[model samples]
Target: MPSKSSARLAALTVAAVCSAASAVALTSPAHADSVRIHDIQGSTRISSYAGQKVTDVAGIVTGVRTYGSSRGFWIQDPNPDDNPATSEGIFVFTSSTPKVAVGDSVTVTGTVSEYVPGGASSGNQSVTEITKPTVTTVSTGNAVPAPTVIDAKSVPARYAPAGDTAASGSINGLTLQPSTYALDYYESLEGMNVQVADARVVTATDPYSELWVTVKAHEHRTPSGGTLYGSYDSQNTGRLQIQSLGATADFPKANVGDMLTGTTAGPLDFNQFGGYTLVANQLGTLKSGGLQRETTKKQSRGELAVATYNVENLDPSDKTFDAHAAAIVNNLQSPDIVSLEEIQDNNGATDDGTVAADVTVNKLIDAIVAAGGPKYDWRSINPVNDQDGGEPGGNIRQVFLFNPERVSFVDRAGGDSTTAVGVTKVHGKAQLTASPGRIDPADDAWKSSRKPLAGEFVFRGRTVFVIANHLNSKGGDQGLTAQYQPPVRSSETQRHAQATLVNAFVKSILDVQKNADVIALGDMNDFEFSDTAKILEGHGELWSAIKSLPKSERYTYDYQGNQQVLDQILISPSIRRSCKFEYDSVHVNSEFNDQISDHDPQVLRFRP
Candidate 1:
């Protein structure tokens, strides 16, 4: 489960900027024709004359960001330059609120430097800036530069530059090729006045006062016209970030499949937040898609309903418990068995010796019961104090909540947080030697991650194996908003290993009984079209049930205006062969602004 605090922290990490040098006082006034803004901002990602002192760099102050440590005003050249590759605007890092007005024609004398937001360790591109600026007002009430129109024809078809490797790792290492790639196209326009006309919203508006839009018709548009967040192989080339430089109330609220009508014109500013964003003074009108909250149909009697949900760090102190319980009851229709993730300890985020989540789970169960749902029995093995990675002191782990009236748990001895589960044959049937046990807790792949909870259950005299997993999240991975070409998913390496381990365990059960009804599901933290999912569904040993949905409607998570799949239910060969199973990604959360969790729970109803 991705926490909003963590997401905001990541945004802050990207937004982090280097300390500015001492400000130089405006001692001398020079001619405005001495240096052009385009000359200062060359055709490359970095300034050609970086570290060199340039005098009398003249432009009209277009915008100002006075809030953060990197308080500065953006200046753009009013005169037109014939070279399409060279940007006419640049950011003057003043460190404090600039004294210049927005329409004031300013002449700045400063040293050009390439400042990397988030520092160099972040691997993000450097933003060309004029540091230690000495500002002089050339003229007042000057007209700003006309924004360059960015439409379908202006944006390149290729989204990113192909460096030495197939995927562009970092644009900072390679030279800029604006004509060839869309990233370079935007990079070339960095800090320049730009406009996106009639942009189609791809991602929903996030808490960061930003939204992603595509100027052109994308190839992977969803049924509702939102862009599908495909694999790393498919890039949304024309996608641009629309950032509001005004108050939060001014930022438009939009969902996937919505449109930004009229033209959004602003300066193209590069930062670690969302790569190249148009810092618009005013946003376009949000055209409603009329997308409403969705509910899954109730399960029939005798049908076993299993679901996987990442409750987003459920704790006794959190207020979202009732909402989550209502979602599980009314939206997921009170699944017979639910594989829950991120169940925090009794003390919640307290660093006390307590590692039990009994109180937390009980509160959710109580809420579910109050919501008119059946009383559910729960089971979970608390991880060693802070061994599993999540919010500090939270001690989050996987848990199971099952309706005892509908299904029965087969608990046996030797089940604990540290012991690994073993399988055996009973009456020529596959059965866990220790039901409700951990799967390979000592395995290297499970290090600093949630160990899978494997539980054996009986429904209508038939046995089923369920594994609840919360794999390593994509926290350390490069974002889609990064400067890299296709972007790097460094977080997948551990998830791939984790999937392999889970697959091996699933194989052990299937090897004992070839038609074993096994389900491995939870917040995988990877996509259905990802390599992690591929490894889990190796050679048809397990079938990803999410793929069974229409390609456009398969996502359970909404990210960056793209509906993506991060939660999944993978079934064994017997379940796939039965063809009697039904799966639904109950869209009660994720899409809505008032979402209880960052993910939407998925329910699979089948007759075994």
Candidate 2:
């Protein structure tokens, strides 16, 4: 069926920073810089031909997607020819396209390709063509700037660098790399601080911590048919792994493409991935004042604090805890307990040759040490080994984090890995009746499904059972049975099964303890109003963290222009009486320019 929708690859990108525009009113910049052609550096002005396409175009790459659904991407160069930085130039798109990602430099091109915003809709420019295409590397006059120590806040959280964005500082570019390219031009200038000018937002294929950008680099195919190159975007490339804490009182939201002028945490680690890669240390947002966050202060006996954050892709990957250890521990304000999904099996491997040889649970404990929070402790009732279930990184499941002083892990019950609750559990003879916007257990769709995790915890004098859930999603394999309908289906049978598992688990618990304080958190993977959600909350006494707010204010994740409540926190009848929840609207993957995980986190606050 030939759809009528325009099929042009539309890469979402922010505008270049200019004195004239506001944050939301972003416009594409123009590419119009003069090419002072020098013989590799001697400095000689090249003659400007009447219609020569060559120009010194520099800008943050706002968008990067395969051109025409092929294996190439267009680097939106906004600062070509220096014409107020509007959308201009085409840096070429090919299978051999350099590892240049979005949010980095779109420099080193010989000609230009321009997209006229909105041929149909005014102000929305689309790249129509590329006049010339050429590739370059550091060896070919593209001198990467020295590294520097910049705050995470200093870097633009969503905005790209404007042309002429000043360099905050400089570090050792060459010395930053423990190893370099054979040409000696250096791969990732580790331990060095360099400011890339006129940058723009790109995409983050990984989670929140990592970013992908575009820049001029030489790329070639290996004998195995894979292309090799390094990322040039500031967010992903030349990353300031470490930095001094920015204004200990405030942690600002990081902007996209902002130059991370910081030093490497250690020497570069290299393998087939690239010549070598370095980890950042002492990193902070480079912008003036970044996201404001305060450490937890001592509170009285009756004070209760709760929070929610999307700990992106909290897989069993060792890095889940390692990468954002500080954010989880310190920035998290030490919530009484954190409900997390995507906790992978300790012994899992990464597709990109990353991840240490450890399970996510154990590694998270270690990451707490790395992030300066040793007191944060965690556990999971669903004790699936790395290979327990057939997940990519072992059993990438959901678990919980607790402040040992505030909560303790007691035990687990209900469905095991082998005999997970499935469609049969949903049907059975218990209730043959199905209500409107309700899931019928008789549906064959949920015949096989992954059960939810129910972990018991004790806080103060009350017993709290926290169920960390990642319900069946809309996509994935059939045997996985992790399926759900998109956008509109309030009651998906498969999703209903997921809701059923949690319901059954809760029912079994209530049966044991009449007024058990139960808090179900993590990525439900379903919106608050969906049939699955209605079934979960149908019990009149239960409370949803987001239920207090209007529909617009309730969203833990965003997808395809629709904001849905996938990440949620549900409270049982007893807990909802005194403990009100505070759903912190932190940025999840998509809008925050992160691809860490598809779901966000939800926090619960209770007062004695």
Strongest candidate by TM-score:
1
Give me the displacement of residue 358 in model 2, in angstroms.
6.9
What is residue 431's positional error in candidate 2, in angstroms? 24
TM-score of 2: 0.46
Q: Ten consecutive residues with minimal summed lDDT in candidate 1?
A: 22-31
Q: Please list the C-alpha lDDT of all candidates, in the order they appear.
A: 0.82, 0.38
Worst 10-residue lDDT window for candidate 2 reads 478-487
Residue-level lDDT of model 1, residues 485-533, one tens digit each, is 5567788889999999999999999999998999999999988888999
Candidate 2's error at 596, in angstroms? 4.6
lDDT of 2 by residue, 1-608 (tens): 00011222131111111111211121333443554222111110011121235554343432333322223333332223332111132224343434655446555545332222222112121222223435342222232333322223333232121212131111111121112211112212211223332222222222213332222211221111111221112112222121111232232233333333332222221111111222222332343213222233423455444444445445553344554566566545556676665554434535332323235665666777677664656554443233222244444555556667666655433334433432212222111111101122223433332335555556676556566665666542111000111112323667776676567656655555556676666666666766667777766434577776544446555332233467777877776665444445344343343334444444556653
| Runs in model 2 lying further than 4 Å from the true structure | 1-300, 303-320, 349-358, 381-393, 412-449, 476-491, 511-514, 550-552, 579-581, 588-590, 594-598
